[model samples]
Structure formats: C-alpha cells, structure tokens
Target: MKSLTLPAVLATALFALISPAIAQYADGQDATPEQAQAYQDAQGCILVLKAAGGDDNLQMAEQAMAKAKELAPINGDDTDEKFAKSMKDWEEILGLASVDESKQFLANCRETWSA
Candidate 1:
C-alpha cells in the first residue's frame, strides 16, 4: 500500500503555508483606500511570485495574496477592484505560471487601475 502519511504531511504543510492568506480572506472583512492601495502593491508581488517559481514562488504568491487581501474591501472604494477577497480567489484560480505569465496577468490586473 502507498504511504498516506507522507502525502498527508506534505498536504498539511502546504495548507499551513497558504493558511495565512486564507485566514486573511476569512477574517479580513471590508476594505479601505489604504487596503485598495495595498492590493495594487500585491500586483507586483504576484509577478515576482509567478516568475520566481518553486517553493519560494508559492511563498511570494502568499505574500502578494496577503497584501491583496489587505486592500480587498467588501465594497468598491477608491479602487474598482470590487472585492479584495475575490481578487485573491481569482489569483488562485488563474493558476499562475512563470514570470512572463505573471507579467501578462498583472498587466491585465493593472488595467483595472488605469481604466
């Protein structure tokens, strides 16, 4: 039989790694102009995380997510990002690849700010 424990352990660690941002999304509610700016900052982190790749990249993505969550608001404030939580959700769903992919993703995200 396969060793389930090893996989379980790895999964646990992975969850723990992402828990911070997950917690932020759950506990964090509403948003401020500052939070919105913070999300904008996250756009940068995402690029680095996307390009950095590997475990380090995951960590960076988590960091960027935290920042994005910070800026994420329940309602639209100064930024039209809509919901920071949603953006974080989107980032995860987007399945970020390498730096180039991240650049494209961030560019699209940045458009929201420009328009």
Candidate 2:
C-alpha cells in the first residue's frame, strides 16, 4: 500500500480529535479509531479502483465503500467539510499508489469492509 501523506494523515488525526462525539456507526455505536481509519481507507481504495477502471474491481470497491460508510458514517454540521478533506486525502493517495498498491488497497478494503 502507498504511504499516507503527512497532511492527509494529520487531517484525519485532527478530525478524529475534533469530532469524536459526532462520529458514530449507523447502529448508534461509537466508532473506534481503527474502525474510522478502515472506513477512510475503504473510501480511498474505491477512488483508486475507479481510476484504474475494471468492472470487477469497481463492483467490489463500491460494495466495500458502501459497507464502510454504513459502519461509520460521517455526521454533524461539518459533514461537507469532512467529505471534502477526505476526497483530497484520497486524491493524494491515488497519486502515490502504483497499480499493485492500488490493488492491495482494494483487497484490504474487501477483506475489512465489504459485507
């Protein structure tokens, strides 16, 4: 997998600290930090898979992304800002990820997040 950029990693850390109270699963359970990170990774993986462009990968990536979001949806008033930041982070990840790395991310997402 590609290493996370410093800014993206920092933004994620900051968001976790600032919005701990607002972040929760669809079932109303508080999300652990690891769960939140997995969710973010799944989102990033989806972007990578989409850019790579294969029907099979896209289908699995979408399923993983959906499951990740269902388990840990971003909530509260700053939802738009949070999503914007996440998109930027995913873009950065996409830029650095090689085909093999991107495929690894997709695999990880399917294993960790897909239903």
Candidate 3:
C-alpha cells in the first residue's frame, strides 16, 4: 500500500473543502480580486516554505503550490499583475524576516494551507 504524506493528506482534505469554489475559477470563469489575492498569498507562503529547505517543508511546499496553481492559474490577466506584485512583496518580506520569524510564518502557513 502507498503511504500518504501529511502534506498530501491535508491538501486532499483542504481541496475537498474548497474545490467547488476553485472549480468555478479554474473552469475559465473570472476569479474575484479576493480569490486572486488569496492565491498569491498562498504562493508566497509556498515559496517561503521551499526556501526553508527541510525535506518535510519542501514536500509541503510542493503540495501547496500544486493546489494553488490548480485553483488559480495566472492567464495573462489582472491576476498576472497581482501575482507579480505578490512575489515582489513576499521576496521583500522573506528578506526582512529573521530566522525565528520565518519559522513562525512557516508554522502559520502550514496551519493556513493545511500543508
């Protein structure tokens, strides 16, 4: 039998909860600004987790990233601009964060994203 990782299991559960709303966006319907912002924030958290560089964190980051992308693809529209801004903002935040702050942020992300 295949073993599921914690991140994978959590992501599956989270997706089950949110997939209906995400599906409408994924199916070429317009995503609201709030949805776009949430996607960008999730991407930023995924990036931060990946940067943290532990095996478990990396796995979680990958799982979260996959779900975020699936839910809100940037299709050269307004979301593209929001995504760019989010990356820049998150990069700055990452640079400014101390190790402890990063850890706390990661912990919060794991809770928020279920990853």
Residue 74 lDDT, candidate 3, scale 0-100: 42
Candidates, ranked, lDDT: 3, 2, 1
At residue 95, what lDDT does model 3 achieve? 65
- Window of ten residues with lowest summed lDDT in model 3: 1-10
Clashes of each: 3, 0, 0
Number of residue pairs clashing in candidate 1, backbone atoms closer than 3 angstroms, sequence gap of 3 or more or interchain: 3
lDDT of 1 by residue, 1-115 (tens): 0111112322333343344444454566454434433544454456445654677566656766655555454323225454544445534534534555545544543343222
Alpha carbon lDDT of residue 110, candidate 1? Answer: 39
In model 1, the Cα lDDT at residue 13 comes to: 36
- TM-score versus the correct structure, for each prediction: 0.35, 0.53, 0.52
Provide the lDDT at 81 for model 2.
Answer: 71
- Is 1 or 2 the stronger prediction by TM-score? 2
Global lDDT scores for all candidate models: 0.45, 0.55, 0.57
Error of 1 at 93 (Å): 19
Instruction: Give model 1 RMSD, 1 decimal.
Output: 13.9
